[model samples]
Target: MAMFVHLTSAANAPGVRRSGIRAASHGQGSARGVYCFPVLPSYTLTHQWLRELARFGSRGGLVAVHVRLDDAQEVLVGRYAERARMAQVVVSAAEAVRRIAALEDPRGWEVFVPRAIRPREVHRVRTAPQVTGWRYLPDAHGARPCTCFGCRVRGGYGARRLRERLPHPLDGPPPPVRVLLAQVAAGDPGDAAALREALHWFSMRRRGPLDRLAGLATHPDPGVREDLVWAVAGWSTPGVTELLDGLADDPDADVREAVEAARDPIS
Candidate 1:
């Protein structure tokens, strides 16, 4: 049998003891399973997922549930990111341990059993240090965080504070609407860039003095009109619907396409 450790909330200890570890899908895929790491020699490595799992606001503290599976049992093994891409390789339980143990740095590596673990397979549950292992990513301590919209989920724990501390260059907060309008009116060589930036900002915040920008609908630049479509697409303002209707027939093919995309973003 190959030994592995699964980290989970201490609050679920009673249930786990009663019914083993239930298999569940992480996201929208067929990769439903219990995620565990091999029982490595290093105690720290064996419970490396403790801190990261805590970040998800697991009820109470965390515990390491030791489990044993047949060496011939099939499992998926890969780095956390590779699993999302369905790039994990199918391997025997014993091979999974051997591969990860041989790696010099197996911080984000994981083994996934595609079904629920039975109570007989569970060896024991023990307390794990809540602070053990890394958060965010392995070795991410003291490193500058990427504050891009995709990387930093809005309203997440410490998300706002982290962005405020280390804001990205292009993804940082935009200038005031008045400041953006001034740059647009100047009509300098940089006006197009400024206008595009302003539109991008407005897209995220649909509540703005959009009337001031109504004139841009016919602005000589077709790109500006296309961007304006995107900016007001989600707004429920009185005239926004009419504005989008008019832009739908724009002479420029790109502007028409933008209107379509804005109306049905899923496509």
Candidate 2:
């Protein structure tokens, strides 16, 4: 939701000069939409470094700039300073110092620095957290994992029943719930894209004995229903599309919009 970028102490100041060079990329998967945040102390905040970070973030890198604002500076209160989809500011210097002082996970490597990008010893800087996201569904009834957008948003009574049968495990393992909550809090675009993709994929595999999505369509959760409305529009399958098309006249305005998005030629 709120992305963070951590710049190393050496490069934390706003006025620090950048070499105008690109840092070495860590391999493709290493770059799975995650950015390295450099961690530094609050006193390191310089105009040059901040400007460089803002510039880097604008180019699609998530950045975590460390800031140790006093109780009155209110560092975390500002809206994000950059406009990149893949960017964020993190107050990591304070976090790192706090954690270190508290003897918590003293491993220095926690502050990541992409190995490939350093131009020189001075250019070597540490980075930020490697965060990933996913939304979880239950294995109740031992249901196979599915991400059909149509099932998530369409189908109908049967689909809703199926979803209820396999409702999300809200209190199970902490990871999925944590990720889900973080996504909700951050309004993450990548997370949103992943959800849409997963639902679409699950929706397309339905030539079987049970219509999974048709079951989810009637899911009682208003949140689930809202998700479905968005998911159904991206589904390209004719069968799924046709099914949604029929719901265009459904009494619910959101449901009708989803159906129209699915079936309307001009949409």
Candidate 3:
């Protein structure tokens, strides 16, 4: 939720009716509150307000503030309405936009000041609701099984998404690899053989004269070393297996585990 703080001209009469904007326009305070109008081009006002709101919300700030002149017209009012709907603020939209525009903008106020504030909410954990009705509905009646993550996300199926993202022992970034990884790690051999074939192709490509990332895979950093192990583990080529077999004795346990996990042979 977003909040707003509104600042009106100090000279304006205290009894101003916000809904009676026309009355405010005819009143005596117009000359004093000129600073309350937006300094940006009329068209850019919306974009500017959006950016400011996002910046403020990202930081732990409670309220979004804008200053409004006593006589701001309909255009300003509409802009405020839009912003007010999206953000939680202490002041009305018209007032906040007007005030922010009136203030002297420091260099990089948008970038620097907001970066110091952190979001109030952190690490939101989403759990999927239990499926009580899918079983009662007819299967294969409406939507075909979606292979992409979009449907799963829409249904709030977090566990399935996690299972889908994990890498298989033999496949890399391809669909076949993703499927193999989705299979139980200990219980399948036909799927394992298919994974072996995919790896075999990957191995040939990685070892061919065109390979560029091979050098980085052998870098001294532990992360790099472990990535290399997982990357090479998915290939079926003798060259890749040979390298992993040699690296089984690597000082890093992560790298060793990756090497051993990828050593499955087709019977």
Go through the candidates in order and give each one's C-alpha lDDT: 0.80, 0.35, 0.34
After superposition on all CA atoms, how large is the RMSD of candidate 3?
22.0
Order the candidate numbers by TM-score, best to worst: 1, 3, 2
For model 3, residues 1-267, the per-residue Cα lDDT tens digits are: 212222222222122232211111111122111112233443233223332222212222211223232232222222222332433233443554555566564111120011111122111111211221122112423754443321222224563454367533443334443443333132323244443443343332333321333443444565655655655654444566556666788888767755654452100
Clashes of each: 0, 46, 19
Which candidate, 1 or 2, would have the higher TM-score against the true structure?
1
| RMSD list, candidates in order | 11.4, 17.7, 22.0
lDDT of 2 by residue, 178-253 (tens): 3433333343233444444344333333332123344445544434444555545445545665556555555666
Model 3: worst 10 consecutive residues (lDDT sum): 108-117
Instruction: State candidate 3's TM-score.
Output: 0.24
Higher-ranked by lDDT: 2 or 3: 2
Cand. 2 Cα-lDDT = 0.35
The C-alpha stretches of model 3 lying farther than 4 A from their native spots are 1-211, 265-267
Runs of candidate 1 with Cα error greater than 4 angstroms are 148-160, 167-267
Model 1 pairs whose backbones collide: none
TM-score of each: 0.60, 0.22, 0.24
Q: By lDDT, who's the top model here?
A: 1
